[model samples]
Structure formats: C-alpha cells, structure tokens
Target: MLQGEEASFFVLCDGKTALPLGTAQDHKRVGEGDTGPNTGGMGAYSPAPVLSEAVQERAMERIVRPTLREMSRRGMPFQGVLYAGLMIENGEPRLIEYNVRFGDPEAQVLMMRLGGQVLDLIQAAAEGRLDEVSVAWADDHALTVVLAARGYPGRVETGVPIRGTEGLPRSSVQMLFHAGTALQDGTLVAAGGRVLNATARGTTLQEARDRAYALVDAIDAPGLFCRRDIGWRALGPVQDAPATSQPT
Candidate 1:
C-alpha cells in the first residue's frame, strides 16, 4: 500500500479555461492520527501544506488541463467543478479519483474559506465564462471537525437529542452546520451517522482548529464524537514522526 497524505483540488472550468480555487486535506480514519477503521471523513482543513502553490500549478498544468483536453477531444467538454483526489508522497502527486463535485469534509473547509465566491464561480462556469471572472480567496485557513453519532461508519444510534445548538457563534470566523439532524417535538436530534460540522476560519490553521474544537466542546450531544486533530498533517509532526493524512 502506498502511504501518504491525501488532498483534493477544486477548479471551475468552462471547457476553455480552468480557474483554480485552492485545495484541502481531510482526516479519513475514524480515530486520531489516522488510526481505527476508515470513515468517509472525520474532519478537514484547507490550504493543505503539501499542495502548495507550486504543486497546485503543476497539477493544473499536468492533470486538470490534460483531463479537460481529453474530454473536449471526446466531444464532452466539462463545464463545472472538476475535483481531483490525489495521494502525495515525496512531494509527487498520484491520482486516487476524479470527482465532478466537491469533496466531503474537504468542501466544508474550502467553503469556509471561499464563502460566497462559490456562487460567482458557479455562475461563471455554468455560462462558459470562467475566464471573465476570478475567485478572490482570503488569505486565511479553515478547519472543520465532524461531529458524528457515537457509532459512525457502523451501527449508529439515531434520534438522540442534540443540545448546545442555541446561541452558538455564527459568523465568518466560526459557525456550526447541521447535517443529519431533525426536529421532533421542537427538539433537535441526531438523524444519521454524521450529525454536525463545527467549522471556523483564522489567520492560521492552528487558530482555526482551536476555534473549531471550542465549538465542538460546547455541544452537549452525548451521543456524538469528533476527532481532535483535524489539521495534524498540515501542522507538521505527529509526536515522534511526521503526520500523514488524506482527503479523505
């Protein structure tokens, strides 16, 4: 098995031009430090340190451009978000998959950074005018920790009342997003394996992570769980060794 960090890059394409929108790394495993069984995604952070501007540019020139070229050659020019899932080892990127939509928790972190830039990008791409518009991303980092039901990626106990959603921070820097939730009898309850997303942005990845964790800790959902190290890979070092993660 090839062991390395995983990342995904997002781009808005109009068959003639591809507009990049940065990248993100996600925690795939259900436990800390990439331990336990693999899950869809436990948490995520944006501006993955591994996918630097140089690497992103290389990916665009090498991967994204070629793929779009091939699609056009086949008379199927892509005209929307083109997502690339990659495994990076020794600073070289290897393709894991290609998605036409946003990556899971990876999208959460990027959207936190992108904000309303999404609408503009989508409109431009849909109209085949991507070159006419540009994405103005903030020089900031974002982290999102998924709050899952106690037994996620397995048998999950649902209908558990979730508290602490009231009076929480909901600003550009910090917020909570509900996923698999339902309101019964005027009470919010967990309705699926993954429940909420505690997300935040900051000047640095560490600061965003701290703010996200604070939001996680404020929740009173006894049936929920979250991974503590969302940005471990980007932050450098695990304990004795370097951190490796995925988009996972």
Candidate 2:
C-alpha cells in the first residue's frame, strides 16, 4: 500500500501457491488463534525460525533489494524499515502484506534476540547505514506469550486484578514486557487487550518453549490462552530439546 512515496512497504509472494503468509504472527484479536476482530496487536515474535537466514538473504537479493533499487530508479528513494510479510505453503514462500513500522510480536522477539544492540541498530537505520550494521544473533531461541483480558477487543473488562509475576527469572533468557498494564492504588491490573508478554530464551527452541510455558503456569490468570506449539514446527524434531508443559 505505497501512497505517492509517503510510506515504504514490500511483499514476498510464493511463486508456486499464492497464499498470504508473514514472517510474524500478530495477535489481532484478544483471543488466541485468528479469532475475533483486530486490535493494536496483543504481542508478536520474530526471526520466525521459518524464515531462515538463507531465505531472508534470498528475499533481500531477489525481492527487497530489487524493490529498493526500483524505487530509487523511480526517484521515490525509499527509506526506513520495510516489513516483508511472507507465507509458505507446500514448501513455497509467498508474500502476505506490508507495513511501515515493525510488527509487534515480531519486534518483541527480534528485540529479545538482538539484546543490547537495539539502540545501535535504530541509529544505523536512521543514518541510512544499515549495510554497515550487521546483525549478530545469539545461538538461542525466544518465545513470547501474550496475556489478554476476557472479552477483549469487543468489551475489555479493565481494572481486573493481576497476580503472580514476582520472582520471575530475570536473565538473558527470560523477560516480561508489559503491554497493557496500569497502576491503580499501587496494584497492577489488566488495562487493555493484551496485558503482558511472557518471553523466554534458551539454547534451543524447545528449551525456550519450556521456560515460557513454566512462566505461563506461574501466572494465575485464567483469561489468557497461548499456542503451545509456537516454535515446535520450526524447531522440528530435536532430540535434545526439553518438553513443554500442557498448553495454556
């Protein structure tokens, strides 16, 4: 949806099957899966694991790089971040949609993976020196689970009491980012569609998945539901990966 060079966007479509797929999954609804109406994204995760480094490189060379070249040739001079949402069906990668800003859950996952270099990356992007900025990824995996309120998107029941979350392991592997929270009488309550993002990183995807599910259990909220198989499909059958708890 480029409008007179006002915004930047890119789409990656599968040459075989024309299905919309993106590297990130946005929690459009307050509920799990793709149910309910859209909201401001409850949470997101990235590096998707599905879009491997090789795939991204191919997309950059074939789709993104060429698109940027075309824009420059047209005098549009595209700049800023361009999100290329992709879908893969029948073992083929395809385009989904485009966005000017970072995808929510995808941003969170990427941030977790990037760790302390986020500010540096942003600065490089601003200065148009993105080519000079190389992304160094940790040999680990991350998973983010969104905590939402009951009847969210339609009718959010705010001011609901939120408990359990103290003593969460604050390591390079585990973090809890607040999404929709507020302080009322010195008590934290659910204030929006998604309230919290319980994220965990580990040496492997299954390890990260286990830690995330453990955090979900510690959180005593009954209104939240997350996909337990978030990274399972990407991780494939890892003999060393730990087992995750029951799905939330």
Candidate 3:
C-alpha cells in the first residue's frame, strides 16, 4: 500500500506560465482505518495539512513549474487540472504520480473552497492566457464523503433503491454531487459503485468533516457504505471523538 498524503493542485498552465488554482487531499481506501483495497476515492478534503504553504511553494518551484517548462520544451504544452499525487517523508515532498485531470472526489472539495471566475480561469489556461487570470480562494475547509454500493471496488450491486435523498442541505457551503446514479421507472437508484458524494464546507476542517458525515448518515440507503473518518488524519486525535469512524 502507498502510505503518503496526496497534494492536488488545479494548475492553469499556458505553455510558459503555470499557475496553481488550489490544493487538496483525497482518501482513497475503501475501509476505515485506511484498510481494504483501494477504490477510486472514498472521500476527500481541501488544503491538506501535509502540503503546507512552504511545501506547496517547494512543489511549484521544484515540481510543477519544471514539468510545465519541460512539456512546453517538448511541444506538449499541457493545460487544465494537473494533480500531483505526492509522498512526504521526513518533511520532504516527493512525486508519486501526475494525473492529467482532477481526481474524483478531490474536485468536489476543491470547487467548494475556490472563488473568483472559475470557468474563466479554466478557459484562460486552455487559451494560453493563464498569466492574466488570478485565483481567489476562500479561507474555508471542505470535505466530501463518497457513498459506495455494497461490494464496491469489486463486484458492486447496483440498481438498489436509495432513499432519504430528497432533503439535504443545498447551499454554497453544503450540498450533494451525484456520481453513479440513474432514474429507473422514475425512481433514483444506484447505478454504479460510487453513487453519491456528500460534501460540505466550514471554517475548520473538523466542522466540514462533521457536516459531510452528517449528510452521509442522513441518507437512508441500504447496502451502501462510506468511510466515517473522512478527515481523520487532518483533524488529528480528538478527545473521545465518535469511535464509529476511527482513522484507518
């Protein structure tokens, strides 16, 4: 198993200039306590603690910028979201993988924390005008919990009836994003392994985590499971916190 925190950045590169839109961390395991086989992503939270301001600077200076420069040098000229899966050891950041696009649940949390003209930024990058675009990020924490069908990352049972989805918070700070779902006979049903994303934002990471999990618990879907400890590593050890969601 790969034991490292992920540092994801929404980069706006225009062949020469590479601008970062935001950073986030994704929980990729299928079980709590970080056990079980790897799924696409079980949950995610924005502004990972592992990627501090200094660490982000190092990543850009040593990793992202150079990569963009080399790509341009080779006439590739990449644009769009550049996700860097990183491994940090002894306070040093190392590259693990470079995803050309945004990771699944990672996009859910990042969109909640980012402000300004998002579409404009993306267009600017794609049009090679990234140097003219600036990003405005909110001083808030966001989290997302993925509700997966039974036997997910394996043989998932789909088409099951899902309930309690009619009434969930739908503000700029809290909402749900549908993933693998469909309507059958005019009824919403689970259509894939990862069905829904319960997402929320707050002033603190714990607040966001709590709000996201609350939504997860509210969904009365049978044969569906989600990791309760979505932001456990970022929240650290809480005194007598709910034991149902122990860190993996």
Candidate 4:
C-alpha cells in the first residue's frame, strides 16, 4: 500500500488574499495507532514535522495558491478559512480534500497554539486586510486528545454525565474544549459522538502529549474515552500510557 502522513493546512482568505496560517495533523480513526473505523477526528497536534517549512512553501506554490487563483479566475473568489487536507509523501503534498471551515480536532490543536490572535486573523481575513496582518506563531507545540462516547463513529450512548471538566487544567498551556456536550438538569453530559477535547501546549511535542494525557486521566466521564497515544506519529511509540478507551 502507498504510505504517507496527512497534514492539515489553514489559509485565511478574503477574496483578495490568501494567507497561510500553519500546518496541523489529526488522527481520524476511533482507535489507537490510527487503527479502527474512521471518525471525524480522535486527536490532533499542530506544527506537523512532516510538513517542513520547505514542504509548506511547495504546497502553497503548487497547490493552494493555484487553486485560489483558479477560483478567482472563475469569478468565485472564496472567503473565510480554507482548510486543506494534504497527504505528504517524500516531502511532497497531495490534496485530500478542501474544507471551507476550520477542521474539528485539527482546529482544536491549532487554536491551542494560536490563542486569541486567531480572532484578529479571522477578522482581518473577513475584512480583506490579510495583507496587513501576520500570524504570530510561538516556538512551541500543541496536542489535543478527543474524548468520545464509548461507542463512537457508530452508535453512542447519549445523555451520559461528564464530570471533572471543571477540574481539568485551564491556563495558557492547557485547555478543555467541549465539542459534543449539553447541559441537562444542571449537569454537563455527552450529547454527541465526540464530547471533549483535552488540549495542552508545551515547548516540545512530548511535553504537550504528556500534559494532554494528564487531563485525560483526570476526567470522570464514565461514558467517554480517548486514545492514549495521540502524538505517536510525531513522538514515536512508547511503552507507557493506558490502553485506548481504558475506562475512566
């Protein structure tokens, strides 16, 4: 079988300019090591190493920019976030799909890295001021592990109470984003397939992975579980960490 890793690239557009924000990669399957059935996204990390600076430039030049030019040429100039899902092999990028909105788990990690500046970037892109603004990226990494209902990407138990969210770390380096949650009888409960995102940022990928997993272990959602090896592709395999979906 052909081998490659997928990378998610974000471009801010305003029908006049397209600006590349950065790259991220996400795990799509419901199980560990990228096995099992495909889901929206199980986890994600930003600043994918496989998409090096040189590779990103090539992708922009050969793929994204040309597509934008074509859209403009066809009198359908696009605005808003253009998320490109690209498969990288031998440092070359191949388009998998294009999403006009921010990706799910991918956006989770990217936002963890981008912080409040993302709002400014979006506003600038919407106002056609992309040329005047620039993304200020930190020299760090972010990873997010998605907590889904026990039987995700298929049938899932709904209305399952989710606890310990308030207890999870929330700071400049750690965060918890509720994706498929609802308030019922004054209780936070799982209302969809993917429920929560335990995200963290650190100086290195390993640190981010460790911190994210730390939140996963502390969540008291009996019906939710997450992959333990979220950054395995970038960080390589490890002997530690719990099994995927080990009951909380």
Runs of candidate 2 with Cα error greater than 4 angstroms are 1-46, 223-225, 235-248
Assess each prediction's global lDDT (C-alpha) against the native: 0.84, 0.59, 0.81, 0.88
Over 1-248, each residue of candidate 3 has an lDDT whose tens digit, in order, gives 55655566557677777887777888777877678889899999998888887887888888888888888889897777788878776557788888888789998898877743778888888888877878887789999999888888899888988888888888888889999999999888999989999999999998998888889888887767787778888876435544444322
Can you tell me which runs of candidate 1 are displaced by over 4 Å? 236-248
lDDT score at residue 20, model 2, on the 0-100 scale: 15
Location of the lowest summed lDDT over 10 successive residues in candidate 2: 12-21
Query: Of the candidates shown, which would achieve the greatest TM-score relative to the real structure?
Result: 4
Q: Per-residue alpha-carbon lDDT of model 1 for 13-103, expressed as tens digits?
A: 8888999977988888897778889888898888888898878887888888999999999999998888999888877777888999888
Best by lDDT: 4
Cα lDDT over the full model 1: 0.84
Return the lDDT, model 2, position 14: 20
Candidate 1: minimum summed lDDT over ten consecutive residues — where? Answer: 239-248
Model 2: number of backbone collisions: 14
> For model 4, what is the C-alpha lDDT against the true structure?
0.88
For model 4, state the Cα shift of residue 198 in Å: 0.4
User: Over 4 Å off in model 3, which ranges?
Assistant: 1-4, 237-248
lDDT, candidate 2, 1-248, per-residue tens: 32210111223222211111234544454433344566666544444655655665566666676666767778776655567766644334445555666666666666677788766766666666665656566766777767667665567678887778877877777888888888899877888866888888777767777787688778866555444445544554324322232122
Rank the candidate models, highest TM-score first: 4, 1, 3, 2
